[model samples]
Target: MKNRWIALYVENQVGVLAKVSGLFSAKSYNLQTLTVGTTEREDVSRMTISVKADDTTFEQIKKQLNAMVEVIKVIDLTTMPIHMKEILFAKVFNLNNEGKTEAFQIAEVFDQGGNVKIVDIGVDSVLFQCTLTERKNNELITLLKSRFKKIEVTRGGAVAVESISSSCR
Candidate 1:
């Protein structure tokens, strides 16, 4: 099985998200994560989608995606190693000293200093933001240890491009 990070440079238009997601669903492609937003160019949007599929099936998906009229570019951006990261926002219940201590520990471990933002908080819960490598994030989950009641966890898809090598320049 091959895990792919595909980037689409597409024209921004109606139903684009739905159409793209539908295509993935129809083709039975498993999308592990995704991020989409308008690019610097006003008329275009960039989408980063991480999907898991076999090599042959991935090739077919690539061909079909490239054939779409709305797609100006379709890049299978997985092979090249690059800076890949995901941001996760987690909400944990903050009830007592135990809760506060555990939540602080969790946040300290996950937070990349000020880069991660704490968006909101309630009387019983604390929301925290974290940016780190996937491996660190995966390890962070183990620290939860059932002490804090996790309210929610959200993450953005990995965004990366081909790393500049000495030979490339």
Candidate 2:
């Protein structure tokens, strides 16, 4: 199954997220990532959810979401020309000076044009944080696995929007 991203514009109210998530759980659809935040209009909230499903399952999810009272709009982002990003903070342990230097180099390469940085450095653990596209984030993880001992990782689920034609561009 391919990854699908769904953007849901919903009324900002209690139990909205729960109700939305409950639908997926009830249907046995696997949700890979879900990020929710308020939009510029405080009364509305946007939820970006990533799931692995085929066309039939995705259509079912969309139908159920549209039926919900809280959901204002549902967009399938998978086929859209979208700008997507995710934040990841990874800690690597058991590093010596040589390992630390290697980690630094890895961070430099993966940082989205230098946006990523070393957030914390401990005696044995080093934390690096970066906001990157999904592919780059996975690349960094693969590098860490092959080169260093990974202690833990925290990822902010992906947030995405359709790429709109800008007058400035």
Find the candidate with the highest lDDT and give its number.
Answer: 2
Per model, how many backbone clashes are there?
0, 0
lDDT per residue for candidate 2 within 51-133, as digits (tens), equals 99989898989999999989999999988788888988989999999998988888887666766888899997789997888
lDDT of 1 by residue, 7-72 (tens): 899889998878888888998888888888898998999988888888888898889888888889
Candidate 2's clash total is 0
lDDT of each: 0.75, 0.88
Candidate maximizing TM-score: 2
Candidate 1 deviant stretches above 4 angstroms: 113-119, 164-169
Error of 2 at 119 (Å): 1.5
Instruction: Name the lDDT of candidate 2.
Output: 0.88
TM-score for predicted model 1 compared with the true structure? 0.83
